[model samples]
Target chain A: MEILNLEGTEDTPKIILDKKNGIFEISGRSLPEDSAEFYRPVLEWIEKYSSDSNPSTEFVFKLEYFNTASSKLILDVLSALEDIKGMKILWYFHEDDEDMEEAGQEFSELVEIPFEFKTY
Target chain B: MNFIYDLHRTMMSQKLILVFQGDFTQESTKSILSMAERNLDSSGEESSIKRKVFNVMVEALQNIVKHSDELVDGQVRSHAAIFLIGKEANRYSIMTGNPIRKENVVKLKGALDRINGLDKDGLKDLYKEIIKNTTISDKGGAGLGFVDMARKSGEKLEFEFPEMNEEYCFFCLKVNVPRDNE
Candidate 1:
């Protein structure tokens, strides 16, 4: 279980998945042209990580902006994380951005996993 | 006879105008945006104007990419569209048009109307609220893009939904950026 780090771009966001430390972070803008292609590897890594180790994963999502497609992909990631036991996901959002906070709540509602929302 | 001369005079007095017709997908929009950016940079335009132009362009391009209905080659290729960027006196205007479904016209019109009605402070509040409340729609109706454009331009967003057919309509949006200070 290694780590995955991607630099943020104007159209995409930085993704950090540290499997070793059981920390996952996605931050910045995410308006990718092809959401599926951009998120496939991240999804696959999460799937593999959940299956291999029952690590106490801490998922952090700090998105300034993301499109509709990216929203769906984020849901997929949340669902995958739910599959793993003893996983703790902390969804962080800016204090001013109630929309993102509500989005986290929505995702939490859909998943059976223990998801917490923290405002910064 | 006089009308023709007036038209010619108007054309001569107007700045360069370029119209892009068709469905502006992500790829094509990206190309056009990059072109606009480069052209503006080379023209030694003021940074403020450049930024406003880029912001308005991005918002308009994103709208077309996500919402336009008419498609070519079995995919929406920015056809049935008209994009115009030109200067009228000291103001720069960027306008984009696309064929929209009749079902979407009312909603889009309402959105634009609301956007146009807001002042700068109102728009800022609306943007903050929209960004915090609006659910990310599956088909690109978060409504933040328009607000962003309004904020960037420091001007009201103008739009029209003209009838095209029973099932579709022509949607046009115009954003203005004044260059007098620059």
Candidate 2:
């Protein structure tokens, strides 16, 4: 599939899903009014990429802020990757940001897969 | 209107950093959030606390837009909701009040009571359990916004429901967010 590059907005995140280039990332604030609607296509793309899973998928999420509504959708996106093998997840939080770090921990617990929490 | 001026004075004396009262459309909500960003910036608060305040504000304001009753006290126009963010020492308190349909009061009361009774870990467990058991509401909320707000603020939500009329009651909610080491 072709690259799925979506520019970030004030209330949404930037999405880059390029399987060929080995780039799968979502970053920025994700508090969209319609969380499900905003994340629908991203979920679809990730699922589509599962057909031919990469040897090892490293999905990075550098989120500044995301509300509860977006949290569920974030889980949806992560759940979509369960079928793929050799999938690695990187969750970034700011230094001393306990809330963000805890959020990553929660998401990780739900994922049933270990995630690398990198503090920047 | 002197009453309006008096209201401003009251908020000022109360150390409220931001106050808005009007119809809450999505467009207007964005402006209030941006104004909140600037208000927090001017206070020199840390970025983490600022983000927490913004998240609570977003959830609070959107709750109004989603559930506030249009005909307040049987009036034709929309009921104007009030949003206030006040800072006192290390505590940042967000207070919002709007008209809610009378019929839903009991349901809301039950939900709020359950939320208020939980400790930190209990709140976290309830949040995850609710997510697993409940579908997102038609309004696009996971019924977990209050839980998230409580978890983020590290405080139980304070709320009140004053009967405004036979058809409606004013629902007021307050979430207190703490700054560094507070």
Tell me the DockQ of each model, to 2 decimals.
0.10, 0.64
Q: Per-residue lDDT tens digits of candidate 2, residues B1-182?
A: 89999987998899898888877867777899888898788868888788889889989988877776455445533456888999988789999998777888899889989998999999989987876666667888878889988888888899999987787788899999987554
Query: Hey, what RMSD does candidate 1 come out at?
Result: 7.3
Error of 1 at A95 (Å): 23
Q: Candidate 1 on B1-182: residue-level lDDT in tens?
A: 89989855764675635557765777777678777878888878876566667767777777777766544335444567777787666777888888887776778778878888989778867754654456556655456777767766677778787887676678878888888753
Q: What is the TM-score of chain A alone in each candidate?
A: 0.91, 0.96
Q: What's the C-alpha lDDT at position A23 in model 2?
A: 96
Residues A4-61 of candidate 1 have per-residue lDDT tens digits of 8899987789999887776689998777776667888898888778778654667788
> Chain A TM-score for model 2, please?
0.96
**What is the per-residue lDDT of model 2 for residues A1-120, given as tens digits with 9 covering 90 to 100?**
889999998888999999989999999988788889999999889878888888999999999888788888888888898668898889999887888898888888877666999987
What is the iRMSD in Å for candidate 1? 7.0
Just chain B of model 1: what TM-score?
0.82
Give the best candidate by lDDT: 2
Give me the runs in candidate 2 sitting further than 4 Å from their true place: B69-79, B180-182
